[model samples]
Target chain A: MQKLLDYGPLLLGGAVTTICLAVLSLLLATLLGGWGARAKLLRPRGDPLNKGLIRLQARVATAYTTLARGIPDLVLMLILYFGGQRALNWVTELAGLDTLEFSKFLAGTLAIGLLYGAYLTETFRGAWLAVAKGQGEAAEALGLRGLRAFRLVLFPQFVRHALPGYGNVWQVLVKSTAVVSVIGLEDLVGLANDVGKSQRDPFLFMLVVIVVYLGITSVSGWGFNRLERYYSRGMR
Target chain B: MRFDLVFEHWDLFARGVVTTLELVALSLAVGFCIALPCGLALARGHRSARLIRAYVYVFRGTPLLVQTYLFYYGLGVTLGQYDWVRDSLFWPFLRDAWWIALLVFSLNSGAYATEIIRGAVITIPRGELEAARALGLSDRQVDFLVLIPSALRRALPQYGNEVVFMLHGSVVAGVITIQDIFGVTQTFRARYYVAYEGFLTAAALYMAITFVIVLIFRQLEKRYLAHLGLSR
Candidate 1:
């Protein structure tokens, strides 16, 4: 009751952490996913000699996506948090440098970003494919090429198509941020858990956390819908 | 990296995998039972819709781990007051970490399954329902004989996703001392300080189970839903 109210400032800060993690993870996922999709679609410049490099890109991206998507989110978080930190320690030991303590926020963000990147790969790839072939051909006829063609003709349209799936990924990503609590990140869930346990009102505190998440999701969903409409204005 | 360590702990890993599967299976089964009626009620869209909506909102909106903590820590304290609950034979099992994990996981998943089933039932072809009624079936008979089966079939694929999600979500059982893979992995990692080997083994098992779940769903989809050829 009154004890829980005392936790308002701490819980508010934790909410900020949750939102920050979600936003940063989403950004990283977008970057990785864009690269992954391009890698998946990478073909030679119509030269047999270029095929090897293209094949390698495609293979590397496929492996990354498969491993990221296949592993459970928690397992991935643990692997990166523990094993990745261990590897860093080993390297530092060998190099005679200071041993490192892994920051949970960084590790958690990277793990989620990597995992969701695999999902967004398919999303972006689907969006890309859904684009009209004529658009690309028209870009070529207009003397636009490579990055210019993509920026002008392809990226905008595909981004719009990617919005719906991207929204889904973002929502799931937001929820997955709670899993980051395992690493001792003071996200919303972590704060609720600590305060709940201390106050002996775990259910009441968690109920409040649930309401907070519902609010976040509702607002975000509304925002995404508005953005989607903005991007989709002329289409249909 | 440490094959010897992994081999030394074979029983631990095996038990972990078995329990993980059991947790997911039991929860998914029980959740579906709760979900079916809730879904049907929600899809009917009348007096009961608001109740089902609140259930789904609370469960789906919240993360599963907090709910697990509430069940194990919060309810664990509150329910200790009831002598009847404490004295029952079921209390022995209920006190087990496995049962507690199953209870929270089931309820959280039940909420999700409600939505999935609701969506599926809501989209049932109106023509089929009219034909069933025309054949002189009672409303209850039509629901049981025609609607539920079709809804289950339609919901199967999404339900498979839920099953796998539950599989992944069950990892949170580790927080409450449940002996699932994640829990075992944590114990192994802590005991040996060999994070790489312990987590890698568990990750492989998780990925393998995910593949198997996907394969199972694909076969089910083929067998039960080949009629919707082009849409798939």
Candidate 2:
């Protein structure tokens, strides 16, 4: 414990890394989620993309989510770290970019982003379903088309409706950032592991890590509650 | 990229699948056993119910990965040396992958299952219990005859979700070097450089398993909840 306090700077750095991973991944996930939701809602149910194509798209989306949600985040982080890095290196080689390398931060962020994007898809899709159809129709009738209607009408309601679930997803994603440590990311947990190894007091280091996580979870939970309240205003 | 290599390793994959199934089944069975009583006690507001609720909150609030590490590393260090515990007949079981995986997975799911079973038990109509009491039935009789059956119906949907969660969570056993489906894929990826193929195939297997489980859950719900104005 004294060692942890002495090495506070390193621990704080890890916490910062943890936050960066979560925030960046959350940003990417939300963007992808919105796009996925729109893809499902905007496309005509009877579009001539062919039944097989539609089924394939749906299956792909479902697989993305199942694979993300079903497997443990630690395993995902490992795969992303070990396999994904190799795959990325291969791509760089193909592109004739000799000696180019992907950093642990980028790999961790993108891996988590991809995984959480699947979760956000389900949350956003459910939120879209909850949006009253009349809300969209009213915007359409007022000459708002495509982007304008989505911005003016759909986005607001979807954000508000999705806030609660998205908050939960955000918490999950935040906790998931810990797994990045497994991938050699210098996230809070990763740093703790390093310190633990160096100091030979893993329990102390892990306890410190747990405390940091608890702090993150508590603060984020409070923030989410506030956001949920803010979005839920004017409802009976 | 290498179809022949995958074909050659089909038997390995099959064995991996079997191990994964065995691990999941063992964990789920153990989880259900512990969960039933814990849930009943929770719902019944028996002594120490508050403590049980707190237990549930901590387990539910924390990520399962942390729980796994805490068990494997923390518990192993702290409790690994007690002579009776070390030398007991259970030590052989306790010292291995199967036991740790079972213990962690069961406890984790048991926490969730408590909520499901409690909700189901409480959702049974108060009138039914009252009627049983009015019939001069013992409290135990009222519970067994009136409460338990009705509660099971109310709980089926959420319990189904628990089933899916436990099945999915079983994949995490791979992290501890248990050659479950995901573990096998990791091995393949290590040997063959076919990361995407192995992972995608494992993902498909998980989907297939989860799909079958979900379908069975649905059928069970329909059968049990048929009289409740529910339709498939």
Best by lDDT: 1
lDDT string for model 1 (A1-236, tens) is 78667888899999999999999999999999999999998766767768888888889999998778668787888778877788899999999999888878988899999989998998999998899889999999999999999898888899799999999899888888898988788888998988887887777888778778889888998999999999888888
What fraction of the reference interface contacts is present in each model, in order?
0.65, 0.08
Residues B57-174 of candidate 1 have per-residue lDDT tens digits of 8788767887787777655665766898899877776677778898888898999999999999988999989999999999999999999998888998888878878888889998
Model 2 chain B TM at: 0.91
- The weakest ten consecutive residues by lDDT in model 1 chain A span A41-50
The prediction achieving the highest TM-score against the true structure is 1
- Report the Cα interface RMSD of each model, rounded to 1 decimal: 1.5, 3.1
- Lowest summed lDDT over 10 consecutive residues: which window, candidate 2 chain B? B71-80
The candidate 2 chain A region of ten consecutive residues with least summed lDDT is A70-79
Error of 1 at B15 (Å): 1.1
